[model samples]
Target: MTKKQPKSDATRRRNRVDSSTRQPKPPKSDPNNFHGSNNHHFLAIIAVVFVVSSAISAFLYRRINHPSLPPSFAHQRGLVKEDVTFQEILTENSRVSENVTQRHFTNPVLAYITPWNSAGYDLAKRFCPKFTHLSPVWYDLKSQGTKLVLEGRHNADTGWMSELRLRGNAQILPRVVLEAVPKDLLRSKKQRDKAIDLLITECKDIGYDGIVLESWSRWAAHGVLHDASLRKLALQFVKQLGDSLHNVRSQRNGQPLQLVYVIGPPYSESEKLQAHDFGPEDLRTLSDSVDGFSLMTYDYSSSYSPGPNAPLTWVHSTIKLLVGEGGKSLANKIFVGINFYGNDYVVAEGGGARAITGRDYLSLVDQYKPTMRWQKDFAEHFFVYSDDQHHEHAVFYPTLMSIAERLKEARSWGAGISIWEIGQGLDYFFDLL
Candidate 1:
């Protein structure tokens, strides 16, 4: 240090100033200086390299794991399974439950649907509001009529019925019958009882709303339908069946079960030439046993005989005879069958005809462009058409207008009306209903 000289006031003040507080040194100009801007430039370069390297690593990893996929395809690859999840099922079930309570009709407008007709379900769904009950004709007995069998159908029918019930909120009562209640089974009371029990169990297990018992002969075991002993046994069997059905628990309302007994046209003693001839006593028992009875007012003329299936006058006369005896009070419990089918008779000597649907008849009418007329006496729409073979054809079919007229007659009788079969694609009839 030089000989110390008394410093000036400004110099002393400057020296007293704190070195820590001194202005930082201006960055050095050397590009390689550790404390210079070159350090910041180096750091930036390293950062850019790290970012680029990370992106490249991610891309390579994806390519290794999932080859041939674009960068944007990452999300789409994760969704592979295409099926309804439990969450979706839960939502649908909730929706169906909410929808089932809204019924369109209080009185039953029952529609009979055969299992072979898949199109029936579609038409049923479309015209669900017009129907209050849907009876799927499926269950039938073996030829001997001892055991119940599913013929021309599958177990999936139950599922389809359930679906129809759920979606349409219509009561689903399937039709059951002993195609020809075997004579031996009827003779053996034990066998008849077992069959009845099986029928009940099957109905309950399948969640059917009700059942239709259609037996050709009250006492099939008796060679004669009018045998007094056979008739007595049939009465007892029906009574037991009714009691058991009433006792079973119902999925709907938790009440007694619904049972329908389909009977042949009730005829007087003189008119009892038909196979199933049940006297007034038998009719009384039927009226007393089941919830309701259906009169099959069709098949008076079959394809074997070329004539009207259900003549209006004949049906009316039968109805009068049914109520003329002990069954007079059971009119309200009766449902008249509305046959949706017809026969086209050949004008030749054979008097043979083919079975045709209402739609089929309409198509024939369109094809042949026949001379059509409505018969007031028969209450049927008639047409005469010549085929390409130059053979004259006579067609007598029930049209929407005629069917409506018959329905009015049924309603006047304080009875219900049921369509013989659905899935005719009868939009005209569907709209009318």
Candidate 2:
């Protein structure tokens, strides 16, 4: 509005330029700048940014505190629980069973009996004395007579362990069992020497009080020991026992430590059982070879008892037979037998079919509190029945009451009983004897 200088070209050009054509200001290039250096717009912008930042931070924080689920870890400390945090022990309803925890006597035992054959028995209701009503079978043993052995390799995941991940390992392994092989098959002199060294180390590793060398592992065709080298090697093994970890076993005022060998009577017996004439010499050789004897008295007459009736008399006769007629003191070194389960067989018309047994008969019974009948001579009771399929089944389960009776009998007979095994495979199979 300065009165009109329509003067120069530059001035006219400037005049033609519209003030409205000028560019607005650029945004401030920094995080500090919320809005233009002008109004309350900057304060509103700052507030919005804070809430968004806080939400992202919180989501990230929560993610770090919680993690994944649990898996069974074998290397856990102590008796680990099934499904819980590693730091927490499952102290729920599974308390220690009394059958497993009954009084452990330290009375010097006359003999230690192992139900060796208890290994393979089905422990089904038919075979076991107590569980005739509920057929829960013991799973991981291999028994051949009164002798039993556990090879945790095939057992850790069966029966009570069918579902759980079996995490622990047994005290012994195949290599350990093989370590004690005799000098005959031994190739190198160093190996024979090392067999002694390694066996002692292995035994120490496995917490064994003593070892029972099964005759089946090494025996002569005549059922007597063939290799004098094996006996000599045995002495070396015993020397290791007496000298190494578990010190010398002192039976009478600390005598030399010893190990035992159970030379089984031939597993196969002909219809005409062996008398003193046929097997006595072999028995004598076997007796001379080991510190003691383990006599398997279970499957003699093809039946658990003399009759189909429960608790037939052979249970006592088995012990009586061990004490040869006119013998002064019984073998005094004998460990007798007992069966965890019973047997079943098909009587072929030819009278030649081998008896059916594996104690699998218990699988057929309806054992929901079946009645228990006692037999006096055998000191135990048993059951025999047929399945719907017409297959005959027999069972001999033991309850705590029955086991107590067995213990008493065993003590009177000159020793304590070694339970067929240490397994948790029965429904209520723990001794209700």
Candidate 3:
């Protein structure tokens, strides 16, 4: 009844305001507020998807690009398996053989075979034509009282020897090491006679064309070379052995047996102060007795320091010392030793260096993708790399170019070359031979 009586303008306006507030006035539209809440949820979902997608992409990329290497590469970087087939080796050798020019070498090309590495056996058969003499590192001359006994005859492969002779006409000279005491063989005439007879009998019985005797180093280690009287007796013993072997005939080829004397390199002046092994004097003394002198020219560096395996300068100096004034005649009989292996040294603490094969050299190259460098002075290949644990390493190895340089140098000196053992080298190494 009171509201019906109120008809004033102020009253009407106040009543209208009150009615609008109570009825909510059909709710106004605020575009920013409405869209902001919905956009926040949409952006959050998009962000999560982007983050997950990015993580997946990164993982996939790493897996696709980088693969794990063999477990053997994990430790002992020096030793690695030559993961190649015989046919693959033959294929590579065939490719290398195509570019080879046929040239006759006046001197013998000796290749050594080791029983431990089966690759040497296969390679010897494959590249038989490249060598004039094949020396299997077998046979040790040990003494039992007055009688002399021979060991390591079980390693002889008659079938392999027969194949080698037939295919390449190479002489099979089994390497003989004098494991007996120096006094037993050098001092006693009866012992020397027995030793000579033992070698000759083995050569005749085993169809060996010759014997590669390695006793000077042993005798030198035993201080036999230091004593004047013992040295003379040692030379006489070698002469006697050589003369007896030359007198005997090989059962396989009616030819006189050959005797190769393995001699150590001349020690440096500093090294001579410590110990003296066989030098130029020994080479000359045994020149008339032995058919060939195997000069050990490698091992210029030791594991204590990172240096070349065989420095070119050192090699030249060594050859110069041995083949003195107009000594090309002696050089013809000398077989310069060439190493096919390499060395890897770790620069970090508790790290040491070791000898590495071609396969091992290649594995390191693949894993690290390091910058390879050619040591111009030493004529070798080397590189530096960091391992997974951030350890730095230096590697020195022989390449085709380095090996070719050595071959050319030896040929220039009119000296034959002897690989330490063919198994330690790459398949293409025989191409130089």
Candidate 4:
């Protein structure tokens, strides 16, 4: 495929301008919040706006611009350089010949998995059966290829150094995310910027993809975005921070393929789930902001009726909710999530809690596997019992059988599938996805 150069229109602007100049801070207002005497959006809208505008400017000026880049900013399109240690990892993983170092992960089975330390990587492979794990952070590459990687956390102290040692020549920590604090300087933008700026500069200088923020909601919305008092300070800090990595791909912590936010099943979730009411479009907006959305379809209703075997229609409708309601563009990006654990309740004389954990459920299954029989339900799975206490129970786990059931859903939905957390599944749950 040719590197298509988009045409330019009234090129009133140059794409070279960084986010600092773009996302302006909102006007100030008297403030009162937890972080007392404060107000403002944390990341502001500058980076987003600048990135979007650049695309536009690039298109409009494509046909007539000189050098393509505005001025001293022209560089060849090439692979984002990989960190030394991780480079060795890729080399080992990507080996092709029958050589000992032919490369373990050259084909790029999985793009990016999260919190993917050694254990996480092992567990993830169980569900993402076909993909090999790689670090999205340190594995810098400009274009797509068979580059498989997983997300790993890195603080200022370790950076990529420790990751390199642990992963050895097999796994690579290509990128690093500075999940640190100036503890002393957090309240002051100047202090915060200086701290963050230092990390960002190191990342760019050393060659990293970019930074992964502390998921936006947990980030800006925590009162910072709304505060009007210190908004300008916050904006300046963020703009400078963004500039440190605007051209960089992403802070490796975030994998490339968008996340499919698994919408918990409303019926089973009861009231514990948040955001269930958010329709597909709302989900789509959320999805657009990041990567994608996922619908969780685990049932605890019956052995044959449809809880574990949720009514085909319900499943179809849920998928439609995101695709049709949210628009196919967004919906198509949806990935379905399946349950990997069981729920059971041990009522305590009239008013006890009903949510029993996997450990307990396993015990019951063990004690009853000989005498107890369960029927699949319309939602997920269930075992019939009229305990002397009248308690209810649900069963699920990503055992071989459970995984088989999930695979059917992932393929049918035409979206990716991810288990809630690898921690919940059986040890060998991913033995075969």
lDDT per residue for candidate 4 within 132-228, as digits (tens), equals: 3223323211111322122232323244433433443222223332223212233555556455554445554543433333212222323343454
Better of 3 and 4 by TM-score: 3
Off by over 4 Å in 3: 1-95, 98-106, 270-275
Worst 10-residue lDDT window for candidate 4 reads 10-19
Model 1 C-alpha lDDT per residue in residues 1-433, reported as the tens digit of each score:
0011121212211221211121212221222321222224323422342343222342233224432212111113231122312232222211221232333223457787765555677767766766867777667654434454434235336656655656666677777766444555556777777777777777677777778776643333234355656656666777778777878877765767778776666433234433345445556766666777767776554222334456555566566566665555667777777776666755443334565664566577657665445544335555566667655566666654456555655655667767777664354455335
Candidate 1: list runs displaced more than 4 Å.
Answer: 1-107, 143-156, 217-224, 266-276, 302-305, 325-327
RMSD of each: 40.6, 37.6, 31.5, 21.3
Which window of ten consecutive residues has the lowest lDDT sum in model 1? Answer: 1-10
Q: Against the true structure, whose TM-score is highest?
A: 3
Candidate 4, residue 151: Cα displacement in angstroms equals 17
TM-score of candidate 3 versus the correct structure, residues matched by position: 0.75
* TM-score sort, best first: 3, 1, 2, 4
Select the stronger candidate by lDDT from 1 and 4: 1
lDDT of 4: 0.33
Give the winner by TM-score: 2 or 4. Answer: 2
Please write out the lDDT profile of model 3 over residues 1-433, one tens digit for every residue: 0001112222222222221211111111121221221334322432342343222342333334433222221112222122322233223432444323332344578887777656788888887877888888888898887778998889989998888876777898988888888887788888888888888888888889999988876776677777889989988888888888888888877888999887666654422322345656666777887889877677554333445677655566567667766776788888888877677755444445666766776677667766555544455666677667765566777665566556656766778887777877787666556
Which parts of model 2 are misplaced by more than 4 Å?
1-101, 104-194, 206-208, 216-260, 263-293, 301-333, 346-363, 367-380, 396-405, 424-433
C-alpha TM-score for every candidate? 0.69, 0.42, 0.75, 0.42
